[model samples]
Target chain A: MVRVDGKGSGALVEIRSLDKKYRRGGEEIDVLRGLNLDVDAGEFIAFMGPSGSGKTTLLNLIGGLDTPTSGAVRIGGDEISRLSGRKLAAWRSRHIGFIFQMYNLIPVLTAFQNVQLPLLLTNLSKAERRKHVEAALDLVGLSDRMRHYPRQLSGGQEQRVAIARAIVADPTILLCDEPTGDLDRAAGDEILDIISRLSKEYKKTIFLVTHDPIAAKRAGTLLHLDKGTLLECTADGLFACKPEDAGK
Target chain B: MAIPLEYNVRSVFIRWPSTLVAVLGIAGTVAVFVVMLAMAQGFQAMLIGGGSRDNAIVLRGGADSEMMSAITLDQVRVIADAPGVARSASGDPLVSAEVVVVGAFPLLATGSDANVQIRGLSPIVLEVRPNARIVEGRFFQPGLTELVVGRNVSGTYAGFKLGSTVEFGGGRWTVVGVFDAGGSSYDSEVWCDAVVLNQVFKRPENIFQSATARLASPESFQAFKDAATSDPRLTVDVFRETAFYAEQSRMVSTIIRVLGFIVAIVMGVGAVFAALNTMYSAVASRSAEIATLKALGFSPASVVASFVAESTVIALAGGAVGVLASLPFNGFTTGTMNWSSFSYLAFAFRVTPEIVASGLVFSLLMGIVGGLPPALRAARLPIIVALREL
Candidate 1:
């Protein structure tokens, strides 16, 4: 786990005592109960936990992808949880860029058109959207593969193209849920390297959820969640709770 | 709003099979519509073309068609002497007392013959109908067992040519010539002399089928009909030639219109089903991708819009195909026998531009209606749950 330098600072994403649940017939399944978190601007924070530990759920709440049942999520200065459907959707589009496990590129479209999908929501010109897509593909080192379909590319290339799509809208905060979960070790390393560079070089805040220690180690801060709670002890630096020897 | 060309084009190409099915279904509907219009037109032609503006069919009172009316030979002679009735230059009244009856001749396909109207006409009937001419060997001799078969009969009934013989009620009528009625009701008949036909049928003194008269003036019709009906000795009615023809075609017209609507509705149902199937399959196949779009900064509304747009593109392609497929049917001619006239009729398919436009609009509506439900499903997906599945 990586360590953070500052102890107190303004957070780009702030979660306040969140509780979430799922209803299966008459019974309720509690996914996250009373989870709290804060992420600062330009920070690269990795969340690590075993399966069913609410790592991704917490990330989703921070990104405004899902609403918390009993608490609030504030991004920048706006309390997102309190926003209505339309307002919440507008906020999400302007603030967050999400990366999922498998690259969800439209199979029939070229990689360039896939990257241009999000920009369609904006009032950008045709030429302008093209320019932004080209620049985004260049950022992911896939400028030449713009016209290729998703099936024509390797797993790494596809993931890179997906990354290009995510960045095309120029979102302030990036949310990645198991971004490397479907890639090989080498491809996973390359993806981690690109994500790390986004936070440090581009000065964008990133909140990533992963089970891989190597991917988690690249973050400037580490958040360890278990049973819907942030552990009290920091591993070595920031929010790391790899209480390995201590728990043993 | 400008949509990306690739977005619309690729979406249609991806769903080609479902698209083709939808187009063909709609095309079948349009074809049905065209054929029905042709049939109605054919029936109308046979009825209207058969009537001569200068001539009229005087039936007995309280009756419509000839089969339901009864006129005595005395009344027929007295009506023929009326001042309104025209006369040939030979000074003879240009009128003929005709007998019309429905009889059956065995058909090749059905094994049992359908009821066909047989008319016994005179040379004066020919003079009244200028358009009715003998295109074959000759007109039947005035008084004999020989008869003239109409153009329609020659085409539909085998052995209905000159020198051929047909049996009716144990009496063999030899066909002497095949004549064309120039697309009139006469085309449905077998023409024999009225006196001989009445004698053969043993109804020499009475005839239910009325007299055909060449009128002096069209305006004299009301006076002529009033005089004849009030004669007490003659209870008969009169109608304008066009009005009579229009009424005759009414039943077949109604039938064709109803069939056309049924076909259109059925086609609509089929196209809607195709649209639903395509959309449902599209949602299932693109669930993961759509979820990813929803998760990534893209709002649920945008994701739904994207999918709806894709489906609409497919529908538009299908609609275009259907419209093109229906184009060739315009002006295509087909033949059928009119139910009221018992005459064979040929008419062209009246595929108007407006019907084609409606077909396309209907297809688009099907797309919108079918796409809405699937779009809602795409919008309702939870990002975290979707990512977990992936």
Candidate 2:
């Protein structure tokens, strides 16, 4: 078994004094303000907050899908927050996978083809690609349903397929936004269990944003946010604290 | 990396109604383009196919058509005896001094009167124009009020059937035969003895409209032209038969071609607009999907290419349908007034492979023009905003 050390000195994702702002009709709205984080490799961290708390924005910045207004996001020591446009896209494809609340699988593709999408960026031969896709689907326990399209699968199954697609390329990190927000309690539990297994068994670094406490409890560490500031969860209650204050 | 092409194809199928709208619009445009060009092709073929490079025609100088030319009998003889003129088995020069006139004929289909060409020629016409053959009956006998009508003229006009008599030129003439001229412009004329026609029409006794002669070989035409023109007695212009027919087809064919292009362009604009609207709607409906693809690391250029490819496939399918829709008109006979000859000329619609190819090329151009803006818009969509859209 691979050992997962949450406080390890080797940090895979490091964000320093990050800020993100949006302008709406001359109003500069600060979405993230002076946020700093360090997530070690193989750590599963979840952020829980109310609407407008900038959880998704922070997730976007870490995944290289968006540039911060200032400061830097470094993944494996490379400053990715400065990358823009096509360069950022290439970086994200190689290093990050995203799972949305709606299970955003391409409607036209079957589950196997959906999982095979990320592998196309690689130079793998067709046989090798097929092998990778099959393995990913089998890992998600959807081996019997490879040919099913998104419309044909239940919500839980679709989320599972999304998970399979996310990890098919073995990306450095998985960024999920409310991955089970659209599911029932039973299906949501199943999704969280699968995510937990991926974190524990496969040593995948995961950053998840969710409103449900049950979903947040699956992560190795839980952080809460209010008014664009992150707070660590403690046994007593959630309070504004630095990354070092966690596990105190 | 890009989305697989099959994704775009399946998306098109998933939204078939909008796809069909663009397809039918482009199909209609291509059909109009193909049919119009076919008309010009058919007309050009009719005139050009009748001409032979080894034959030459002599018309009065400055006269643009045979109907406007008048050659005196002396000039005709001089042209017949010109150097390089071919000789028949009987040692006679193979030349025909022909007279051209026009008479109104009642159309069998429309009952409206249309001007038909009446050509008066000598017996040597058979030697000079070897493509003309009597299909139903014998050729007209000389010095009688007998005439032969072309197959197209016989089929389109009333009272021109064999064994029938028609009143014209202040007298009645018998339709002795029906001749086919191998799809040439000659198929739109009536032929009778030149001497009888001049006498009946009250033209000067020794004057004919033109003289056509077979040269010893195609190479002899330049010598023949120099010799015929050097004589001070003859004020005439000379041309090889093929060159003359091409000149005759120039005006009408140009008009049809220009009009076809204009109509196709106007209709093509409409098609482009239709395609643009369809693609915009496609992008709008697939906004979240596009965002997902972007989030998955597909370059914006790939998305643009995917959409353009889909539009092109739709346009090509429409072009094929347009070409197929035009097949029924192929070889279908119709008649129009020849601008140069000032007489009715019958021809078939020709749908050549080149015409079909041009139609497809035109459709492809429309697809590109129509697909571009929407594709650009799709590529430039803000990923975060697009993802948030329902």
Candidate 3:
């Protein structure tokens, strides 16, 4: 998708000339090469590619979960390419919110506690954290379900709770790795609504990586990737298609 | 920092097999620990209980225990006037000069025989030891060639029962009574009159093996020591009854304590290895969960602490069970050879609070030591790789 509104000009995420490789049993396996991209604040974009296309590898690099062999990744002003271990954890907690396809909510915690996870890094009191969690759940319209556990919720409901968790810390960016990949169509739509609202209502910069074209179609800009390359930029606002797009 | 207990509990639930294996390993360690501690307790109790605080043992000037000492009748008479020696209201000496000997015999129980100490005592002896009781018969006529066997010395060999005759040192002695001496050293003694024993074992400088005297007060103790030691006429040493028993207690307790520590160390090492195995399994299995937690911003320290705490909980559970397992052994009486007496010394297993506490701390330490490596591995794992394990 081409930039239409030119609204989010300042970059929230910037990745340059990133490359990664692994040395296994005395052989080198290259995973990513010369990857370059930028996403400004409040933009929703999708990363689509084949298996091992390095969508996850690139996302891992951008999320500061892994260090790139070569490149710089700046998220909300901090270059996190060289941050190690606990420092990386600290940086990740403050800067990025991740929504996984399986919705990796800690099973031991209740929905409220799951949302409160990232905020544990903040200096907020329990009451303060609770208030923020309530607001986040409220924004996703799951305020009444704050006490439910992950196992107690339906797939869409769990995803919505995950979204609430992602936004609870008031993070700068939302990174979804195939967010709807694990759900049925109806539940996926409900999750997309919540995710779309995160961008539209809270102005969170969103990056969704997925291969299902219908899932990709929901994004404002689609960066179609086949072999780790940005092959196409579809010109459409996030799910800008008519209501019929939800069916197809 | 004291981690909230919920984290530990949740961690156990997440890694149940690892936790169970750790608990079971710790359980085995604890079981052995409890049994050993109980044995020590029983042995210690027997040794400590076998002595009296009011009665003092007077040994030859150079000797340590009655089994090794012999004193003349003159020394006994001299020690009776020692300042702390309690006197009867009838103006008689409250202490008794006794003859102690170990008669060799084959045992009926365990088929392992050892010498049994026989003491020749007088009228004042019963008054000095309140635990002395004639359970089966009246007191023996002291001047007669009659004898009484303490209950512990009875029923272990032929002619050991009440009214059974036995010949010792090629002399005939009639068993006239059986007594119970409330589980002290007196319980192990077969009794006869000093006059009768001196006549039978006659070299009749009227020598006895040792003297046991009752003291009246703490203040008069030094005077008694002076009476025994300062006078060249009395070649002997005097100790407070309490002090003497306390000394006797150390010989047995020190051995029990040292053996207990050695056993605990060995079992602790085994438990540590088990805990290490369980923790590694836990960390390996929960890598994805850990990665997710890391992604959620929990510090590696918190994660490490949670696992260690969980392992400790398992270990503590095992230790608690061990303490309980040891309880039945408490007061379970058994006897072993006392090298000093060349006789079977009886004792009960004691399961004390200090012992249990030390065991628990040991288990906890084992868990912590074992959990550390896996915890570090978990902490250092890349968040991406961990999450990918899901």
Candidate 4:
């Protein structure tokens, strides 16, 4: 197990004593409690947990989609958890790119248009935006499929399009929740290899949530979340955990 | 940032069934609204167009219309001598004493009996109403049972065609001519010699229903009215013919307006509900799509604007169709009873530009009302929850 000996002062993402509570029918459920973590830039972290283990919730909090009930989440020196909805949305556009398991590419738009979505928020001219979208599609190996719609592509191709959309704006971080959950083994491996290249070459800080231990092994840092706290894992990650204690 | 317009447009085309339902509902409502308003406009135009600003009608005091007034020949002569009366080329005051009576005639289209205005006009009538010109044959001669059918009523009533004989006023009056009255209400009347009509109807030849006189100018109507009413020998009310006809049109116009509004409101409510149902369904079906847009950093206001624009486009399409559907009724002539004169008045439907504009504005308003709530719902939906939706 790799453990830090000091506070991460120059870390890209800093979480301190974070708590998240959800009220359901007058009952307050603590989804996350007193979570502390520091992630450096260009680190590829994989979070493996069973359902209701708060992995997605923790990712949401870091992406500024949800506010923590207590404590602070600082990204690039800004307290994102304290931002309002509009400010957070602006921040997300500038810094965070999300890829969902369902590959939520707008069904009505072609692959090129879908990748161009986030760039619309920028002051980029039409030609500049087209250049960036083309480069992103090229990176994801979807340059030839730019004119096809989501329904026209297979699950792997749709997820590749979603990836192109995420990186077209050159965001500071990528938050992918089950990016390959719907794909078969070969498709999933291809997606993971592309994601690894983004981290190594583009230096984009990526946080991936997964249920597969093989997927977790591809990350530079592997951590397991249970109940409301994260546990460190060895270099082999899930292989080091007891079978029931790993993904469960 | 706003979502691209193509997203909303393609969504509309992709789900054309619901969009079509909304479009047709708005179209039907606008069609009914435009046609109803056209009816009122046509009726009012025909009546108000009958009068000239440079002329005055002298009626017995307290009579609102010519049919309700009875003035003696001596009173008509006194009115002719009024200070502001215009003189003709022969230096005679331009005054015409006319008698009006309602005759029962069968409608050509329905064969049902209807009360038609029969006006017994003196020789000076054509000069006083210069807009009335013989279009088919010459005017009737004095002391003869000859009639001139108006252009609007020429073939609308049985036996009113040119050269046809119809019995009225205890005589067989021959239809000798057809006159065009510049699309005025006078185009709905039959004209004959006053003396001949008085004799056949057994009324005194010295008595006439009203007298029309040309004023020196439009500005001289008040002076003429003052002169006529101030004469002690004549008990008459003088009105600028334009003002009198305007007042005569008020009752029917108001009825038509009220009826049109009532029908439009009822149908408008249904159209709005249909729009609401269609938009709500669109929002429900597009929950995931909307969530993805929001997650992509599109502002809530932009989402709202996009959806509202889609709804407006649908409504405007419907409005255009409605306008086109109502155009064919323009100038389609029909007749209805004039409550003031108790005579059948013929007019055509007038689908004016103003009514078309109003119909479009009305549909636009419906689109906004129907779209706002569902758009807000779509905007306020929690992104994560909606993302999970099917």
Best by DockQ: 2
The TM-score-based order of candidates, best leading, equals 2, 4, 3, 1
- What pairs collide in candidate 3? A1-A233, A1-A234, A1-A235, A220-A237, A220-A238, B41-B349, B41-B350, B42-B348, B42-B349, B42-B350
Q: List the residue pairs that clash in candidate 1.
A: A235-A240, B61-B235, B61-B236
Docking class of 1: acceptable
DockQ, each predicted model: 0.32, 0.60, 0.42, 0.55
The global C-alpha lDDT for each of the candidates, from Candidate 1 onward, is 0.73, 0.88, 0.75, 0.87
lDDT of 1 by residue, B79-189 (tens): 887667888889888777888766766544455565566787666777766678888877777778678877767655666767888888557889888777776667767
The digit string of per-residue lDDT tens for model 3 on B121-188 reads 87677877767888987677878878888787776655678777788866788888888867665566
True contacts kept of each: 0.50, 0.56, 0.52, 0.46
Runs with alpha carbons beyond 4 Å of true place in candidate 4: A1-7, A24-27, A233-248, B58-62, B70-93, B204-207, B214-240
Question: Which of 2 and 4 is ahead in lDDT?
Answer: 2
When 1 and 3 are scored with DockQ, the better candidate is: 3
The alpha-carbon RMSD over the true interface for every model, in angstroms, is 3.1, 1.2, 2.9, 1.3
Residue A105 miss distance in model 3 (angstroms) = 2.9
Report the alpha-carbon TM-score of model 3 versus the true structure. Answer: 0.85
**Candidate 2 positional error at A140, Å:** 1.5
Between the candidate structures 1 and 3, which one is better when assessed by lDDT? 3
Output the worst ten-in-a-row residue range by lDDT, candidate 4 chain B. B381-390
Task: Please write out the lDDT profile of model 2 over residues A1-248, one tens digit for every residue.
Answer: 11122233347887777889999998999988887777888988888778999999999888877789997788898899777678887888899989999988999999999999888878889999899899889888999999999999999999999999999989999999999999999999998988999899999999889888777778877777777877644455664222333333
